[model samples]
Target: MANTFQLEILASDRPFYVGAAEQLVFPTVDGLMGILPGHESMVTIVSPGELKYLVDGEWHYAAISEGFAEVRRDYVLVLGDAIELPEEIDAKRAAEAAERAKERLLHKQSIMQYYHSQAALNRAMNRLKISKRHNHEI
Candidate 1:
């Protein structure tokens, strides 16, 4: 599509995506945000959740970690702490991690530990959700 824009998803460990996307949807600390070609330029913090991108009339999904997004008129750059595609996610492993994180939360711990556990739980849940909804791994 002529309206498509460049999208680069940079994971801390590796580059996740580098291509033209017709549309984009990602999580933010405030909420979910969408971007399209010619959108205004801005930067916002990203939250762990399902990142959706439309390319060649197809919507792709990925499990993204906390980071930030830079939006521009002709491009959108996502600098993610981590990123996992559907095929990379293991349903059973994610489920087990989620359960472990939940159990950890049930017990008292330091503030940092609580936050770490929460982050783990959130990532696991997000991965499981995306895997089940998109990959039919339920």
Candidate 2:
């Protein structure tokens, strides 16, 4: 049997997940990272993207935004600005948001506004992608 480690994912105001996982995959600033039990301990910034893990003989996934994870030998703690399950994403809403962001990007705006719009666009795209994949899964 694979060794299990505690995985605790924290959102802004709530605990998202608290359970045992055999492995974890999260988006880091550098790229995607996978962690296993007895892995090296480290802390890194996580980007907005899909975070997945294997647990209880199945795979679980979450959309995480602007988070960082602390990986330890027997535990991984993730704190994020936002986190949501694929099922929680409303595809229509996300599509609308993506359209809005795209429109905003096409026009002239302050640097901050442009960045914000780009970020929104990225988030919406990721949510849409995750939702699509989830829907196809039986």
Q: lDDT of all the models against the reference?
A: 0.93, 0.91
What are the runs in model 1 whose C-alpha is more than 4 Å off? none
Model 2 / residue 14 / CA error / Å: 2.0
lDDT (Cα, tens digit) per residue for candidate 2, span 16-100:
9998999899998788999999989999999999999998779999888897999999999999998989898888999999999
What's the residue-level lDDT of 11 in candidate 2?
Answer: 96
| Pairs of residues at least 3 apart in sequence or in different chains that clash in candidate 2 | none
Reference-based lDDT, residue 4, model 2: 94
Model 2, residue 93: distance off in Å is 0.7
Candidate 1 residue-wise lDDT at 36? 87
Total clashes, candidate 1?
0
